[model samples]
Target: MAGPRAFAAAASLSMLFALSPATAQTPPTESIQIGLSTDAISITAGFSGADLTIFGSLENPDPLIARQGRYDVVVVLEGPPRPVVVRRKDRVLGVWINLDSEAFENVPVSYSVATTRPLQDIAEPAKYKQLSLGAQNLYMKPVDETDSPATIEEFTAALRERKTATGLYSENVGGVQFLSQNLFRATVRLAPNVPVGTHKARAFLFKSGMFVKESSAQLEIRKSGFEQSIFRVAHDYSFLYGVFAVSLAMLTGWLGRLIFRKD
Candidate 1:
C-alpha cells in the first residue's frame, strides 16, 4: 500500500509539470509581406493627386504581442533614381543669382512614407539611420566628395527642404493600420507632380520598437490619355518633336501678330 501511494504521487507530479506550460519550444520567427493589386498605375491629364493603398500580412505574429499592440509597420514609396543639381541663390547687388551648386547622383525623385505611428515612437533614431528609413535619414551622395562636410550638409538640407516644399518628400503618420492580427493596410499620398517611372514600395515590420523584417514590391507609374502620346513622341522622336515645337512657336507668334497687331 505504501509503494502504490508513492507511485500515484509521482504520476500526479508529472502530470502537473506537463500541464504547467510549454516554454521549451521556440516560437516561430515573424516576417512581413506586401502586395500590390496591380503592377502599374496610369495617371490621366487631370490627375491632381491620389491615395495608393497597399495591403500586407504579418507572418507568424505572436498573438500576445499583437494584442498588446507591439506590432508596427512602416511603408515607403520611392520613385526612380535620377541625378539632381541643387543650386543656392545668393543676393548679389540686389539680384538673386545661382552661386553654389551641388550635384547629387541616384537621388530618388520622390519619397513618401506611411507609418502605423510616428517614426520616433516606433523606433530609435539610430535604428532608422541604420535602415535609411526616412527622408531626413536618407543618404544623399554628392558628386564632389572632396567638398567640406559643412558644405555638403548644407546642400543636403537644402535639397530636402526643396523636395518637401514641392510635396515630393512627405511623411504620413498613422497611415498604417492592422486590420487583424496578421493583416495590415497602408495608404500613401501621390503628389500632384509625382514623377512617372518605376517606383518601389517597401514595408518594414517592427516588434516592440525593434526592427523585425522587410518586404518590397515594384510598381510602374505611367502617363495616359493624350499626355502619354505626347510623352512618347517627345522621347521616341526627339528631333522631330523639337522641329515641330519650334515651328509651332513661330506659327503662334505670326497668328498672334496678325490678330492683335496695330499698324
Candidate 2:
C-alpha cells in the first residue's frame, strides 16, 4: 500500500498540472457599436441652425482593449430637389480664398469630425440651406466673405469646377474652419426668386468612405402672404391667435348689444 502522505502529495501535484496551462491565448476583439441617443435622433426643422449629438460604444471581449485611434465621422445632407453646396473661405488681402482644398460644388452638404479615444463628441453644423414648404422655395445663405470681392468670371469658373452648387449666390464670409481637422463653414445664398414651399433636407455621416448614419429635417419657407398665412396659422401659431381674435370680437359685440338694450 502507498503511504498516505506520499499519495496526498501526488494527488495535489496532478491537480495543479491539470488546472494550469503552458501558454496564454488572446481573446477575440469585440465588434464596435455606434448610435445616436433618442434626444439626438429628434430635431426641429426651419431653424437658422441646429446641433447634432452623436453617441456610440466600442466593445471588446477582453477588458484590456485599445480604444485610442483616430476616426472620421461625416454627416451628409441628401435632399430637397435642387442640389446645394455651402463653401467656406477666408478673407486674405480683401480676396475670397477657399478654406477647403477641395471645392464642394454640386456635392452634398457634409459635416465631419475627427477624434481620438472613446468619448462623447458634439458638433453643430450650422444651416447653409433652408428649404421652403411645398418644395418650391429654397433659401441658402453663404458664410460671410472677407477677401476681395470675387468677379463673376472668377466666381463662375470656381462654380464650374466645384463639386457642389452653392444655390444662387455664394459668399465666403463669417465662416470658421475646424482647427483639428479639415473642416470649414461655407455660406450659400438662395436667390430671392426661389419658389415658396416646404422642403426636405437630409443629414448623413460617413467614415473611411463608408456610409455610417443619416437623419433628416423639414424646411418651411414663407414667401407670399397666402402661403405665410396658411403656414403661420396652421403650424407656427396653431391657429390660437385666430381663435382668440374671433372670441374677443364676439364678446365685445355681445356686451355692446346688452348695454344698448338696457339703455
Candidate 3:
C-alpha cells in the first residue's frame, strides 16, 4: 500500500492537472499559487499532525516591488465542516452530569492561518472580518435557529475553546515570511484531529495594507493501508464489524489460555 508521502505526490499531480488549464489562460489572478511545495496532504495511521510548508510567489512583470510600500501575504488552510455537539457538564451529588447541550452546524473541523505581518497591521478590523482573514472572525452559524442568541453565542465560544485546546483551530500572526520579496513560504501545522476530506488552501495578497488579489488550492486527506480497510468495513457493515470484533476478542482469549495452560 502507498504511504502518506506517496499519496501527497499523487495529490500534487492531481492539483497541477486540475489547475494547469486555468493558469495558462488567466490574465494573472490575485498573483499567487499554492503548488509551491505540495498542494495536498494525506494522513495515514499513526499520524500526529505535521508541519506543512506552503510555498508561493508573486507573479508580476514589474520589479519585485512596484513602487509600493510593501506587500503582505496571508495563507490559511481549512478542513471540512460538520455538525458538532458541545455539552456542558455539571457536578451533581459527587458526580458530573450533562447539564446543557448545544448542537452546532458547519463548524470547521480544522483551521490554521499564517500571515506576513500581524493581522492588525495588515488591514483594519472591519476589512479582516469581511475577508475572513482571522480565525476569530470565521463564520460559524448555529444549526438550530430556535435557540436563543445568548445560548448560541455561549455554545459557539465553548466550541471554539474546545477546538483550540486540541490544536484544531489556530491563528498565527506573522507566520508568512518573504524569502526574497517575490518568493515566500509559510509553515502551518495540521492537527491530528483533522477530519478526512478535501481541505482548502487559500492565499491572499495585500499591497500596501489593501487587499489586492487571492488564490486557492485544495488538499485531500484520507486514510490508507490497514486503517483504510478497517474504516471502510466498519462504516459499510457496522453490525458485522462489531460482531467480528467481539468474536476476535473471544478467540484471542481462548488462544491465550490454551498457550499458557499448566498442570
Highest-scoring model, lDDT: 1
lDDT of 1 by residue, 69-175 (tens): 99999999999999999999999999999999999999999999999999999999999989989899988999999999999999999999999999999999999
lDDT of 2 by residue, 144-261 (tens): 3342345323443454334224233222222212222222121222332333344333322323223334434444433434545665676778679789779989999999899887
Model 3 TM-score relative to the real fold: 0.79
- Candidate 1 segments whose C-alpha is farther than 4 A from its true place: 1-24, 246-263
Q: Among these predicted structures, which one has the highest TM-score?
A: 1
Ranking by TM-score: 1, 3, 2
All candidates' TM-scores? 0.85, 0.26, 0.79
Better of 1 and 2 by lDDT: 1
Better of 1 and 2 by TM-score: 1
lDDT of each: 0.85, 0.32, 0.74
Q: Model 3, 1-263: lDDT tens per residue? A: 34334223211222212234455556344466655345445567777667667777776513434435378888998889888899999899989999899887787789898887788888888888788666777767777889999998888888888888999988777678776546677777777677788888888888777788888888877766688789999999999999999999999999999999885
